[model samples]
Target chain A: MTTKIIYLDHAASTPLDPAVKKEMDAIKTYANPSALHQLGLEAKEILNNSRSKIAEILNCKPEEIIFTSGGTESINLAIKGIAQNKGHIITSKIEHPAVLETCKFLEKNGFSVTYLDVDKDGLVNPKDIEKAITKETILISIMYANNEIGTIQPVKEIAKIAKKHNIPFHTDACQAGFLDLNINADLITLNGSKIYGPKGIGILYKKKSIQLEPLMHGGGQEFHLRSGTENLTNIVGFAKALELAQKEDNNKIIKLRDYFIEKVQKEIPRTFINGHKKERLPNNANISFLDVEGESILLYLDHKGILVSTGSACSSEKLEISHVLDAIGIKHDAAHGSIRFSLGKSTTKEELDYVVKELKQIIQSLRMLSPIHLNKEEIRK
Target chain B: MKIIGYKQDKAWLYSNKVKEHFFNPKNIFKSDQELEDYKNNADGIGQVGSPACGDVMEMFIKVKDGKIKECRWRTFGCASAIASTSILSEMVIGKTLAEAKKITPKDIVKALGGLPARKIHCSILGDQALRKAIENYEGKK
Candidate 1:
């Protein structure tokens, strides 16, 4: 019998789909796309076809999608590239560190970046973005969906404002693409690993009109924008994964997500949901239990073979609370107790049920031992 | 749960004493009133760290006739850190200023039975905050 482990942390990274794995395996037996030979031509054909497939899913032209290393590189290239040309940028405080840190580096280099705050639900007002825009503002880089809180932003409205002001709009859609292909962005970043694709593959969608100062300089690959020989296998797998994720019924995923949320909320008291209650990603459910640390809860669940995330997996090593949590104005005590449960196409009700059961036990036990809770009780008495 | 760090490992895993403090801290106390009422007011207060750094504490001292009459604290940190602060406050109360100055982070940890190695910083933070508060009190007088 196979040991059952409920894997609910898809937002961190998903296992490669069997179909994507097969596609990757097939690509391994190929010549480099850059070589000058029939095999190379065949490989080039496969690569271009994959790119076109991904573009089709994203509702963008094939030529606009430039493959890169992953989400981090894509975000860095998009932010730094635009910030170098234009000295000012506007972004939200809820953005992933990939975008936030890149902005910080740009700021150190004399670029002015306005980090707009988000509402309690982690939604950035497009009005705020518009108001923050200055004559020197060249880019507005916001995330389509937050990784930790799963709050979706008003990218379409923000994009419209950017277009009206003749500014480039870049959104890191690595989390959003797992739900849909709503490419309401001038420049969009997507990562393969976030959607059951092979790791080390990502795409940057750039409209033809926007001019960017290139981050990489060398062999004029990736239309002279990104200079590197592509990891063909991973790119092929990434495209396949995107294609599959896009084709699936998003409503089904949303229903499952809702069911899980409903169950958890009903069973667990003092549980507060993070992010927008309705305008969130279909597969994300972030919640914080009162009087408990998320790290401790995660450790307990991990021992019971129920894997979930306390915060962004990328920044888990940092002791500070998540920037996403802070942006939504969760109190420090509650922020430290936040947990993100992101689902995937493979997730099921049975798995969610098991996770809910395990979480209730762990949270109750942890709260009992919490000094904060005890202190509150003492005062109550 | 698997303990990840050397500090937590050294302080939590092998020692039953550290676990006792972490799970069941003694001297947990809270007071919302300003420290102004006491004749020997704990005016010079100090707070270190914030929610962002995962630990926050406020330490206050009341002095009478050149001796420490009372010490009180409030903290928002991990169990070991909070417990250590609470116990440290209780330990230093009624002691002379000179004797209280000798109290180190180790003393706070020892008072809590023993804090986990990872949690030694809690004691350190509490000690620093308390010492700084004392220094501020001294500066005023």
Candidate 2:
């Protein structure tokens, strides 16, 4: 028999909302949106309505919204599409792999990139971005909220810096769709899966003044930026999900997130919370339990039906420490023990209490098997 | 052979035997006090790896009449590392030093039904600790 799953990995991906599913299941748009028939015109009208709804929420023109496959494609189009021959780009060290890897690909293609560092709390200094800009700098891409630590960046300040330098700015806001959407960025990326919508659909908002190179050449879709047959069903679900996500009672989720963080720290010894205390997202709680391997603890927790993510190398395919934890200056041993508990709207206090109790037992059992000796005095503090 | 039914198929990372040993390991010290007590009472003690490098194994044994009367271990590592050490302690408990030394990491992996390729390094650790504990026992005589 399968145990009841207490899902705490919302930052990874959230389950689709029932309303979104209902909306998608009701869709009858089967003909291609580009076809010249009455059915195609109906499909195009549905597509435009979804775009207008998203644009209204984001407070931008409807023409600014360009649909892509997902967050990765949107990010790639923003970074690579804006980039031309061998110029400098500015981004933070704590960006998601989509942005980081895209910049790395540009670097290999004879572009110079300045990866600005984050502080211990994983906050990037806007002044650092201003200083990194050069005459050849073409784009500056930063994340709105980090997926691992949930540390939100000062995107407005960074946007002002980019504007002063006459450089185009992009912010991957896939993790921040539940919150405010009025970000002052030239290019913004949002996805469906993170906001309780269907996967495989993403939105890229490009200001009308910016010139972008098309990544795909077929049918001249997505303003000729990303060419593909539109995923009409997913687009409708994405808009509905984004609307419902903003209407959620986020204060309730924040309270549970804080309760989980506080309970884990108080009950489990030698544990400390990662990321900033005040500037973090309402749904994320990253904690490092000293001296225990993250994957071992994860397996133990999984056996108890508590789902979470970890930064430990054993859990990663690369067998490499998390770049986010590494950028925040957490020691290797502490990084190896880190686990992320990202809460969702359905998370309740009793569920969190159960998780804290299970986590305490798991950490105690793992520590008994561990050979590393933690300083008792340091842990007490 | 299920890790979690939801997002990933982590069961593919290990065999059923490995998961069994990992969840409820064999021949492990019950608590910190018991481990401290055994450290003082064990006939030979061997430790391998460091916490900084992310895996460490500590093995303790009690020898009687040139055979291991008891074997117990502790480890700070991943699933394969802990399971390997737990099964290794059980494998060497009643064996003579020579016979125990003949047991290789391959043998441990085979006994556990096989670990992933990247995690094979985790299996090597238990064999190293067992050999070192045997060496420590022989060095005294």
Candidate 3:
């Protein structure tokens, strides 16, 4: 018999909700939204309705939303669109690679970016954002919540700082869609896949007052910002997914996530939780098991029909440590032992209990195999 | 419950042989008692990589006359590193030190069907650990 699979990697990607799928399947307009014919007008109407639905959920004007490929593209557009040929940008080190790499590319293109340091809990100090701002500062880009560690940044505070400086603030809220959506920023990046919607569709919420250089040049679509044939099906599904996500009462998920974190730390010896306990996302639990490698634990868990994600160097192609963990001041050796368990709507308490049981055994077995012995004092750190 | 094989999405991540070794690693210390026993009775011990770097392999061997009679190993790493050391432990058994020393990473990769191109370095680690284990044994003599 096949073992029942337990999925705890929702932060990586969530399964498409059935309602969202139904909405996508109901789409009948095949013509491009940009076409001038009658069918195209119908598709355009559907697109506008979907955009309006999303705007209603986000509390923004329908015209301010620009659909892109996904969160990466949305972020690229938000950062690159606002960037001039040479200017200063401020972002935190714990930001996702999309933001980090885009800043790096800008650095190569004559822009100077200050990668602000985060605290031990992976929090970006708003004062640091203010301190880093200069006369030449163009924009401030920071993630709403980190993908790996799940530490939520102080977006409102940073937005206040950016407002005082008269700078555009961008927040990648891809991982925060399930949580609160009252983010006050000049530009916000969100994607469909993370919210149980179809992939390859994302949204960039730009205020009516802001200006951006278009990343794509085509038929003058997306208010002359992003020009392409609109993905109507994905847009419909995304809107449905966002609507459902906003209505969801996340107390159950938050309880389950807390239970998992508490259970794992209690049952597994020498295990410590990464990121801030109270400030993290309700679905995320990043734990580090000392003296054992993350990829080995992940493989063992996968063998037992439990899917999770790891940030260990062995898990990646280049064998580099996780930048989020590094920014949080976790040692290089300990950084390789982190596992992120991001809960979803379908996750149950029994599933989390099973995961903890299996994880205890796996960590014990891997510890027996390990040559390094970490003491309790070391684990306390 | 037994997961029969690699899932369809991850079937190409590693070869079937590598999966076999990973799921059923040979001569691994499954308990603290076995590890303590090996610590006292093993003829030679070798370790490579470091915990700081995300992989550490501990290899132990027992010799009979001039040939390696037994080998046991463990690793703190990914599936490929564990599988490489697991298969290497089997390869070194029943061979003289010189013969085992000649077993290159290519041979281990060949024996295990093949590893991902990026994981070739993981196989090399086991080879180096084996050579070091032999050296430790010879040095003791």
Best by DockQ: 3
Each candidate structure's TM-score, on Cα atoms with residue i matched to residue i, is 0.76, 0.95, 0.95
lDDT of predicted model 3: 0.87
TM-score of 3: 0.95
Residue lDDT tens for model 2, B5-38: 3333445357888887998899998977887888
Docking level for model 1: incorrect
What would the per-residue lDDT of candidate 3 be over residues A243-274, giving only the tens digit for each residue?
Answer: 99889988889999998898998898788889
Which stretches of model 1 miss by more than 4 angstroms? A312-319, A374-381, B1-141
- When superposed on Cα atoms, how far off is each prediction in RMSD? 7.7, 3.2, 2.4
Better lDDT candidate (1, 2):
2
Candidates' interface RMSDs, in order? Answer: 9.8, 6.4, 4.7
| Per-candidate DockQ vs. reference | 0.09, 0.42, 0.45
Interface RMSD of 3: 4.7
Go through the candidates in order and give the clash count of each: 2, 0, 0
lDDT of 2 by residue, A1-381 (tens): 344688999999999999999999989979899998999999999999999999999999999999999999999989989887779999999999999999999999999999999998999999989889899999999999999999989898888989988999999999998878787899999999999999999999999999999888898987888788899999999999989988887888888888888888788888888899988889999988888888898888887878888876653233456899889987676677889999998888878888888889899999988889765334321
Our tally of clashes for model 2 stands at: 0
